[model samples]
Target: MDILILAILIATGTYMLNAKEQRKRIALLGSHLANYQIEKLMEALTDGYLRALGESTDERRQQIWSLLSTTEAQLTEQFSRFAADFAKEPEATTRVSRLAMAIPFAEKILPSFTFDMRKALAIHARGIAHVVQNTSHLAPKDRAFMMTAELFLMQHTCHWFCKSKTIATARMLARHQTPHEQLVASVSADTRKAYLTLIKGG
Candidate 1:
């Protein structure tokens, strides 16, 4: 009976600690996110991509693609700025554990299992900018697909920063019906190489 009571106390304490850590991460990300319309821009660009792809006539399709270019540039600019700003945060505030579950102070306790999220965000910034610039002469459809993958992958990292890796992966699958592996596979070769090199955790 005593053991059971002690176990319950430990569990409650741990839960509270985890929640506190998560809240800090959520607040930090939210404060920066409030300064820009990254989410809104992503939605706009995604929808515009679909519309551009759906247009049947060549002229209309071309026009839609041209129209979305501005949005693409805007998203790239905002995200790069966000990443740059976020990277300036202190290491203590940006350390994210790679473990499957969130544990308060685990990043410090297990440095091998943790990584600096600033690096991940930097990789994402470069990937996004590279894709959006469309300098490789990729077809409109290909560019859209690659950009979608880049955005999804970036979104995944944000979720991971705010929660456990397992939770983040589950949420990505639930919301976008996209597996993390698929997102990685769809990005450009340069983006894929850099991302995979930095993201060694499950």
Candidate 2:
């Protein structure tokens, strides 16, 4: 009976500590994120893509894509800056656990199971820049597909940092209708390679 009570207390304390740690990371990220309209841009691009894809007339579809091209460039520039600034943060503070579940002090306790988020953000930034800069190299359909995958994958990492890999994966499916594995597979080859390396602690 006494051991059971002790175990419950320990579990409760760990949960509180994990939540507190997550809040701190979220705040640190939010401070840099507040400077950019990333979420709004993402939403606009997503809706624009859908509208453009649904239009049957080539002329109207082309017009919609033309309008969204500017938005793509703007989002790319903003996210790149945000990633760069966030990377300036020390790696000690940016360590993310590879564990699927949130475990208090897991990052510190299992050093082998942690990865630096600075590298992850750098990977995402480069991926977005490549998709935007290679407009001529990729068809419109291909570009939109790759960009959506890249953004969803990036969002997954942000959620992972603030929460756990499990929660991140669940939210990705719930909000974007995309599974975590699908997001990884759908991203560009360059992104897939670099992101895989970073997450694997390479």
Candidate 3:
């Protein structure tokens, strides 16, 4: 009876430890995958924005705008579904707020004739920061390095969006780069290479 009880306790302890570790990985991966999806969705919106600017005809602009508006709605619905599916115990409540901050495109994806570029960039930066902060609890060996790398990728995506719109607006948005670029530049070469590899789907 004593031996059986000891064995059961040992098994329970091991299982508990493994479950905790698995939860941590799941949270990290959920955040990472959500960020990736956000980036790709933004890329599509940016492409639409650039296409709208390049068109010389009013009819084409109307068509592009219609298509983009639909895309925006679809992206939001998809993100909401993704979050709901992953909102499990011990993470559900926290995940709700984290995903909101991390995604940050509930309304911003719908571009208009006179959209506020500065405000959009600010929201984008905040989204990236929130994701990094939320996942920091995982305590990776190089958390700062990894966060900065992710930030750099995000900033570049935002910069390209603005730059594609026009050089003048891009110049104006360039001032928003001080903090993100500084940390991004601090990452080691290997870390950067690794980021590139992961980003490229390698």
Candidate 4:
């Protein structure tokens, strides 16, 4: 009877260990899938923005505006889904890091475009930076919700700016100060903090 009990205990321990390993594998796969989806979404946005810039006429601008609107809708949907997934699996640090890396790329693309688009992109980038900095304090589920809301706002604003003809005039009338430069400085400060934390093994 003692031998049988020991055998049962060993089997139970093995089952638990196997379950833990399976969970880790599942988490890693989810993170990779999330990263891939985000990259695809960013590429689509970048392509749409570049196509808009390449167009030389107002009719082309309208077409580009439509494309941007559709892209924004898609981004909103994707962000919502990501938020849900993040909520379900709050321990996915790899997914969070992947999301954070996309912010800088988005920032780089923003400055390559026109004045109005650049400013709008800068605002969005700053908001994302804010989300990244604050996320450390948040429960993963809450962090995901916050990030999703910010992205949705950014997409909505992008669609509005792209579709509106008056934005060009507004861009002309607005102060020509370099907000993007200021945003970069701010982001660098946050990056420094992150680096320091990493070095300290925090």
Candidate 5:
């Protein structure tokens, strides 16, 4: 009877340990799935932004605007969901890092319209990069993930910016005006300043 009781106690202990391990594994899996879903949403937003920029004709641009607006709404909804889900998890650092990384991509995907719009987008992008850099220092692994995300984010931003700028410049050429280099320069300068401020924690 003594031996049987000891064995039962050991078995119960072993079961509890295994259950704890399983819980940890499930939590980790949940975190990974959340990250994957956020990344997919970001990609969808980027694709929609690119599609909007590709529409050269005014009528097409209008249609693309509607689509892009809807995409933006969807992206916002996804982010909100991510935030709520992440709040219930222990991996707050990872969640914050993912959000920081996603900001640059979100800003990049915004539609460029007037000079003001371009400037706002550039400034916002720089600000987000700055924030990411600052927050990433707290978690090295998360920082690495953010850096990887930012690389692709910046690439897409530059691609869209260059294409849109070219079209604008061509249109200006047809109007017999020098391409508005000043506007680009000013916006670029503002973006750089915003990035510097972020780095300096200003």
Candidate 6:
């Protein structure tokens, strides 16, 4: 009877430890996936904005506007899914809240309204910075690298938002180097490649 009790206790302890470890892994994975989703959303928005800016015809611009609206709705759905996953983590929840605040205003601006591109870009950049700052507990190094890539994207988005969007302008923004890029370049080759792929939505 004593031996059986000890065996059961040992098994219970092992199972509890494994469960705890599994939770940690899930949380970490959720954080990374959230970052990836944010990158995809931002990339889609930036591309839409640039396309809209580049088009001389009102019909093409309206098409891009419609595309941006659809992308915003899709991103909002993705964010809700993320919030469900990260609901228990306060840091994650806070980061999600900050990121969410950036979406609605831009979406509410009608196609006929004179939109302030600078203001729209600022909202996203600010939210990204807030999220990056608040989410350091979950895979800090990876999050830091993601922050760098996001800021890099933000800078170029603003650059093109101000300048006339041409192939030359787009290529120039893509080619522009920042200190963040230099810093993140030293991350593991796989990590760097994944960051680029995520930002580019590939």
TM-score of each: 0.94, 0.96, 0.32, 0.34, 0.33, 0.32
Q: Which ten residues in a row have the lowest lDDT in candidate 4?
A: 93-102
Q: Count the backbone clashes (under 3 Å) in each candidate.
A: 0, 0, 0, 0, 0, 0
Report the C-alpha lDDT of model 6 over 71-111, residue by residue, as the tens digit. 65555455445434434443321211011112222223322
| Local distance difference test, each candidate | 0.90, 0.91, 0.43, 0.44, 0.41, 0.45
- Give a tens-digit lDDT track for model 3, residues 1-202: 9999999998787666545643554464455356446546646765665676578888887778677655555544454444344343232222111111121221233222122323333333443344334434533224333443444444543433222223223443474443534534554444344433432334
lDDT comparison, 2 vs 5, better candidate: 2
Model 2 lDDT per residue over 47-155, tens place:
9989989999999999999999899999999999998899899877899999999998788889889999888998999899898887448888788888999999999
Q: So what's the TM-score on candidate 3? A: 0.32
TM-score of 4: 0.34
Evaluated against the true structure, the overall lDDT of model 6 is: 0.45
lDDT (0-100) at residue 133 of candidate 4?
Answer: 55
Q: Write the per-residue lDDT of candidate 5 for residues 79-192, one digit (tens) a residue.
A: 445444444544322211111122222222431211222332344444334433343343422332333333243333332332333443455445424334432332233344
The prediction achieving the highest lDDT against the true structure is 2
Return the TM-score for candidate 2, rounded to 2 decimals.
0.96
Residue 9 lDDT, candidate 4, scale 0-100: 94
Best by TM-score: 2
Which is the better candidate, 3 or 4, if ranked by TM-score?
A: 4
Clashing pairs in 4: none
